[model samples]
Target: MTHFGSNTLHVSLVALPDAVISTLAGILDVMNGAALMGLGDAKAQPPFQIDIVGERAGPLPLASGVPIEVQKSIDDIESTDIVIVPSVLLASGGWQKGRYPRLVAWLQRMHARGAMLCSACSGVFLLAETGIFDGKDATVHFGYADAFTTLYPSVTVHPERVLVISGLREELVCSGASTTWHDMVLYLTARHAGATTAQAVARMFALQWHQDGLAPYIVFEGKSDHGDGEVLSAQQWLAQHFSVAKPVEEMIKRSKLAERTFKRRFTAATGIAPLEYTQRLRIEDAKRRLERTDASIDEISWRVGYEDPAFFRRLFKRTTGMAPGAYRKRFCIPEFARS
Candidate 1:
């Protein structure tokens, strides 16, 4: 949390196999750009010294198969003010145990030396494996939430959050999704360079803060791979008839099990209760309508099975972190925004 006064901040971005190429390049550019701002001369010493560090000191291929020359190796960097882990390409089976033991050990050592650790998107998988995030609140791209939770049950995963800060000194920072690196960079700038410089960088890069979190972008496809045939049938039925009156009751009846058994199985398979699943279905439908049409909130709510628009508004906001009108304003077509 030290500001850039006279000492130049050393920021290191970890370059590992499957690390995002653009993210490494982007962070290097932004941090260096922030350092050079208001220096009055091109040759002035920048406030930040940015380096791309890898396991080895050489060209490394990223997830996109593009090669970036590493400026330093992890062995060369004894310590740094900040260490950023960019999103990696998660395999179909998700984070593998002991796949990157060297990198995990390096992260643990750096954090022990008081280097702030930050990650974006699936990069949190690496940090979680470092064991620093065990008892802290963290977040990742919503699509990876279930897998991340399953892998690290000790960590508190807030899938709806856009940014999460936890650690003894609030140095363990994480951002949701890939593009959210913009938010993370700006936050880091503010933390180390002050708000004025952070704003300058924002204006320079046209970076906007994502204050509304990740709920609006989350597609609620309930867990359908849990292998409960009866629950799967009920899920399919509800998908087509989620807007029906008393849909949960109808689903329970169609499930052929006793109501208690049906509810238990549904929750077991989907990780959500039947009523909550129904609500998610309705909210997702309402979100689609809000984005694609100029329909009034009341009309959309009624179409999505809510009898009262007021109640629907509350539910929509609760589920997505934005009011229906606000969601529409943020995501609707350009013409709709202008109108």
Candidate 2:
């Protein structure tokens, strides 16, 4: 809203007690570097103005227990071109509702005033609190997708995406996982500064975009915290014998509940259907085997219960975003095999 030049965007990083300092530092380095490169003069004033904005001005300690001096408070910043909420160390209890009322209000005001707002990983949780992401597509760490979905059901979560750009005018930007902060900053640099400046900064930082997405990194662990003893027992049994033929049907029999009841309870407890649960267990087994063994994809597929190697390959690619051979090549440990 207060833009001065094509390359000049006022960038503000929100500082919170539980914020990840490394993410903040990475964005600062990339943005500053891009600004310097765009100006083409080390001595000239950088085109971009970057600041650490906190709830209250002064020193704020991050989750790392290190203090960072904030240059401006949320109250002091009336308008800014861009606001970045860095990733935070989200506790198991999750983002407490109404805990950051002032910050949330300020974020809404900024969005309403035409300032672009961005978040990385769990920072999306904070940004969501502002209601700016309602009915919009966003992304966060895959591990936290369920929690985020539960907390903000209105915001569709694409856990597998490395980045999601949404909202009216696409002013709201989100990046998945903690490290994708690099992608978000680079995107901002390319948009406000120039693609050339962004490329130079990326080269300097050795930053790479995670094009493979979070699927390859997600480990399928069955959710068992629900208070259903039958579902828990079924999950445990499936874990040991997922490759068995008609495993979901066998699990239903073992659960001792009616077919519909068992299916309902399993889906409720695991957040997936019985058949999907079995597939995940089998895929997890295949992943481990691929990581530690030199077995052919056909053999591994058969070992994991799928008789049709072609079907297994397709499923593997669908669930993991990588073919079996690609997964093996990426994850296999040559040192372990040698040992």
Candidate 3:
């Protein structure tokens, strides 16, 4: 395991210089806090180092009427393990040529040398502007997806998911909205700091340990302003436990409905059977584990509670139109190799 100082995953924040938004800074605050807490709790320093770097080393204004001084410049970003570009105003208008001149040059220098490029929220817009996210699997905040899609049609944008870590191409990742940033930091922490260290950090902050590939949006905990009591209860349970579907018998017990009546009621309530609903939940869970964990097909099958890998394979392949292995190749953000 590495400490923050030891791992030091330098993050370069590309501020739009007068972009008037501190979204990036805010994200940095949270990430740095998480890192410090994550690493400090493990009784170790995280192997990661985060730097809010940009075109220059100076004060940058935010939409909140505040300015944060930039401590690192483009030249200072050399050989960084991770370069993050936060959301800034497009008015800078430097990335139109996929070459914001200085930004482009910096990105080229680091990218060519195999550094990871990370984009947060609207920051993804700037990354796309660099032509680096092109043909890559990425994501933007839900609000900005439409504009991003309209602007960069060549890049494959995943709308349903909150964050995307592209197929193991030199550590490129694009994520925005929901708790995606939290997941990203945890991932980086685990990678640099190790799972044991990461767990220690999580325990320190009382943060729940997360499995990569589960989108933050799927955990909508607060009650919606609409829906009946039974509906809301079911929906809440579904949201919380969709990854590990409750047994139908358990659900029936909880609902206190007879089998025949429960079937009719559940179907009428959500237009889906209890069993079917649970199946969908398991499928989604299996799909997530498939994409994130380095575990083999059998390992993943078991992780999702499938006793028979063959049946899991059939169900997965049938639903996704590709074998589990092939699906991993097709949809996995960080493509695996036999190291």
lDDT of 3 by residue, 8-76 (tens): 566666676534354565556645664555445466544656777777788866545578777888886
Which lDDT tens digits does candidate 1 get at residues 1-339? 223456568888999887988777887788776655552234444567888888889988888899989889888878898999998888787778788888889999999999999997888998999899998999898888889999999999987888899988999999988788888888988877678777778888888899988889999898888999889888888888999999999998787789998888889889999999999999999999988888999999899899999999999999999999999989888973565
Which ranges in model 2 have alpha carbons more than 4 Å from their true place? 1-6, 36-47, 255-265, 333-339
Candidate 2 clashes between residue pairs 3 or more apart in a chain or in different chains:
none
Candidate 3: how large is its RMSD?
Answer: 14.2
**TM-scores, one per candidate:** 0.92, 0.88, 0.54
- Candidate 2 lDDT trough over 10 residues, lowest sum: 1-10
The global C-alpha lDDT for each of the candidates, from Candidate 1 onward, is 0.86, 0.86, 0.64
**CA displacement after TM-score superposition, residue 37 of candidate 1 (Å):** 4.3
Global fold similarity of model 1 (TM-score): 0.92
- Per TM-score, the best of the predicted structures is 1
